[model samples]
Target: MTGQLDVIREANLGIIALNRPEAINALNLEMIDGITRALEQWADDEEIRLVLFEGRGPRGFCSGGDVRAVRQAVLDGNAEEADTFFAAEYRMNGIIARYPKPLVALTHGIVMGGGIGIAGHCAFRFTTSEARFAMPEAAIGFTCDVGVNFILSKAPVHRALTFAMTGVPVGAADALALGLTDCAIDPARRDAVRAGIAAAAGAARIDAALGALMQAEMAPVGEAALCAAADRHAGLDWTDEAAIIGTAGLEPQLAQLALRSPTSLIAIAESHHAARRLSHIGAVLAADLRLARLLCRLPDFAEGVRAVLVDKDQKPAWRPNSLAGVDRSSIRAVVGAA
Candidate 1:
């Protein structure tokens, strides 16, 4: 329907394809608007029985939102644009979460940040061996939005916090193990699976169609080592953040925390903790919107985006600079800003 997005109706199935391959299909406000409009139009239509999501790119499904653009808007003193971007993006995430019909996401390659926001909420998520998932917002000086915290809340807290705070990319096996995705299908079979779903859409035979297709194409993924290790150390006192980070086995994760923005880390950790108690996606997204508004205006967001996106220097001068420099009052202010 738009240059950056492809929306089509085929055999009663509504399909959405993210088409910005140059940027790994990173979403802009226009793409978000297009997706939301399509979902809104299809929501009550008797002809549309299912919705399928896919991305057009060899590199990945979606890298994330186009935060570089948001950063530019902020630099131009148009913070309202940044706010509008997040709000519209979050609204689209909410729509995907509450869609009336069964929704399927065929995510492959790099699916991070907002990519997870959409795919992770779908009713049926299929991934390829090439799929890599992460929430790298903390690294970008942004708190995880798009209801990812809500998804991470269901996992073991230690692992969830590590993944959320560190921005570590995980493979499809780990994604399934962490409950980020539902199944792994052969990459070559993706089109067949889509065709099968499309053919079965109108007859209300989705379950049966997927069952047969999955039986034929499902690939076996090995157990995820990260998840296994997390389970092995699940007894560790996760609440004692310092002691856990200082633990010998978690040195790599601790190192990742050291590289990210201190303010973002504090906000991300607090948000992840808060999400555990959130019973629904709507509540978590509301909390996310509140944090996003405050966090984007802070200095770290600008610096982080500059270093990681604009300059590609990978060196960000965080406002607080280090975790020790961040105070409880600062954390409370962000978490309570909403």
Candidate 2:
């Protein structure tokens, strides 16, 4: 089954599997709707106590949103449809963040963009040795949405800004260090951990097991370095900060991720610094939406997508080509109320 939203009841626990291995369990509109329905149905069910959500396949839990569709919609000039999709997606993200139950998200592999939307807000986010987390929207010439502002705000300053703008994939150690994963399990031991959850007497045992897993996977070196980098980048202006961190190799892993666009990275870094001052989620989303619309009007977005996803040409010719060309006024124009 390419897109299976399996809802199985094991004692008081509900297991929801994202079974789209073909696409690494990418979140399409249908998948989002399925998840929303499952959550709503299970929310009222007294019989179900906890929810364990996972994606099938060894390659990933959930890679991201089905952006090909969004890209196509934009190419066809159906901007309203793309906007509607993002609106619904953001609402779903908010719901997940505020969910009442003990929602456990088992993030085993590539978790990016929309994957973050599903797993980022869970009560317990579990990961494995292979787990790679990122936010690459800026690489595609889009701002981070899907309640990412909330996650960004909670993250260590420069660390959050760097990851969002660079679209870098953090390994298990870095992920734990960044507090993205509550527990880290060895890839081979993931099954054992799941079985342990199944056999646990109550939430207490599950929590204990998770705690043990996290402690076992902790990486002091990675944590300390990341924290130091965040401190170094804090309170500096975006351009100056990016210049400093980019030169210092604050995140060497970003070079290997290869999914982010240089143009998007610049845009993302700029957005984070600007959004950091905003007081509310509505303000951030509105600002992001304006930015997204402006990006569509610009040539960078389509060109970036084409170069990366269409032509498979690793090189993208950005319009501005330089950060200096992207003025504060242009950014402000996007954030300003119409």
Candidate 3:
């Protein structure tokens, strides 16, 4: 239990380390502000050529946003707090996407939702063998946002759709295959790689330096396996919405979403399709804001959070309870109908 964030200015690297082991480094509004400030300052600093982010302990880099807090805000009738949080978080996502220098993200343990927003947009994304990654907003009665659709859009379309719809966890090897990560390495040599990155002063030198460090730990032992299920779905015709809806790869998550806010599932699906044709992540962010604003006005987001977090009871009696009956018109209201 170090501070929630440790902002260290090394000789060569600006380290924005997440230190909240207790909460698995789950981000809140204050931490988002700190990170945005750190990056904005480092973007202008001439001495620092690279920025690196990582988390502490074995629990992982980050679980996601502090949605429990957002749920609290909704319960208190202060909707501005949740809206403000999303605005700030999405802005931080933009900064990470357009960072001027080489941005390195070390992903260990679990990285989901906001965690992916922070690390996935970096120039160099490094994942340990133990890393688990996903965009799991569907399970929480929240639609996918934070520019994830941009990343998903650029990846293999069907595979990306499966992940967006389903909340399945992808391992380090699957991430590499999906082009989500630049390097996959054993968790043991991470500290050495960090030391080398922090010691180098030139941004141009990071490419080779990081590559060499990754090479040291690329052994076959304990490496994560490729996501065969996602691969199976990727080869299918995703244009058929029925195929996606009935995908075996998505079975586990389908059940979860059914018991959740089913309308959010529709929003997530539409957002993925909307981002598929866009070039910039800015468009994705805009769509996210639209969907988020509408979802906040709905009841499911709060009810889902209450059942999952506040009460510790896993039963969220969702308003339609099933996706079959949720109308497309309602889903469109969240994502904005084209």
Candidate 4:
């Protein structure tokens, strides 16, 4: 709507491109609304055969949500506004996840946070060699949301938890092996692929053909390191503060990742564990919303944002800097029944 998004019609296809190159195509409220509106309009359009989603810039598809704005809102004591934003954003994510039309997401470059929200739910998701993906909410002292709980739970056990807690980027091959991406295409072929979809017969036919094309182009390679890491940490009681930190001691990278935001890491571990037990999608989303609201009240969220973004300090003075310092009651407050 702000000219930050380009909606082009190619035969029977609707190509929705995020046009904010300056912010690496970050999803602001307007972009989210535009995408939601486009999907709703095209969902029932008889002529539209498929929806092709991509970001305009070379850096990647989308970096994530505009968290700097959300952080500023929190700093300005506008928690209510932030809550409304998340509510709308999460609703959009749910709609995309269950969209009626064929949705093909070309996810290249830095796909994180809200970027994941947009691309992760498509019927067909493709990644290029340059693509990097993650659910890095914990790094900024936030719980995973934007329907990430659903995505993570669907992933292999410890693989999901490790990704959530560590905020590490997974490459295209790793993503495919983890079921995070369906295909790995050379970035050069992106436009041709879009054109191919536009030329296809129908939405359903386009999706089926896309799967075949991906299978022909990219072969799946299993992620051994991720699998090994998961196997190593399985069944450990993450709630035991000392044990949680101690488990990271065996792996320096994991320790450093946990040290990035001890509070958020612990909170996410708890949130995901609780989410695993829920039987309904609505329940999982409600739980995530409740936790996000509570995150605004915590000091670490603000402190983490200031250190990471505002000050560019790269060091946050997280309260109780150690996991042992986190109170059980506070953890209970975040993950408690909604």
| Highest TM-score model number | 1
Candidate order by TM-score, highest to lowest?
A: 1, 4, 3, 2
Q: Count the backbone clashes (under 3 Å) in each candidate.
A: 0, 1, 0, 0
Model 1 scores a TM of 0.92
Q: lDDT scores for all predictions?
A: 0.82, 0.68, 0.76, 0.76
RMSD in Å for model 3: 3.0
> Mind sharing the TM-score for model 2?
0.83
Candidate 3, position 279, lDDT: 75
Candidate 1 lDDT score relative to the true structure: 0.82
Q: List candidate 2 segments past 4 Å from native.
A: 1-4, 199-236, 240-263, 274-290, 293-297, 333-338
Error of 4 at 210 (Å): 1.9
Q: What is the TM-score of each candidate against the true structure?
A: 0.92, 0.83, 0.89, 0.91
Name the candidate, 1 or 2, with the larger lDDT value: 1
Score candidate 3 by TM-score against the native: 0.89
Which RMSD values do the candidates have, in order?
Answer: 2.3, 3.8, 3.0, 2.4
Judging by lDDT against the true structure, name the best candidate: 1
lDDT of 2: 0.68
Please list the residue runs of candidate 3 whose C-alpha ends up more than 4 Å from where it truly belongs after superposition: 202-204, 219-227, 233-260, 333-337
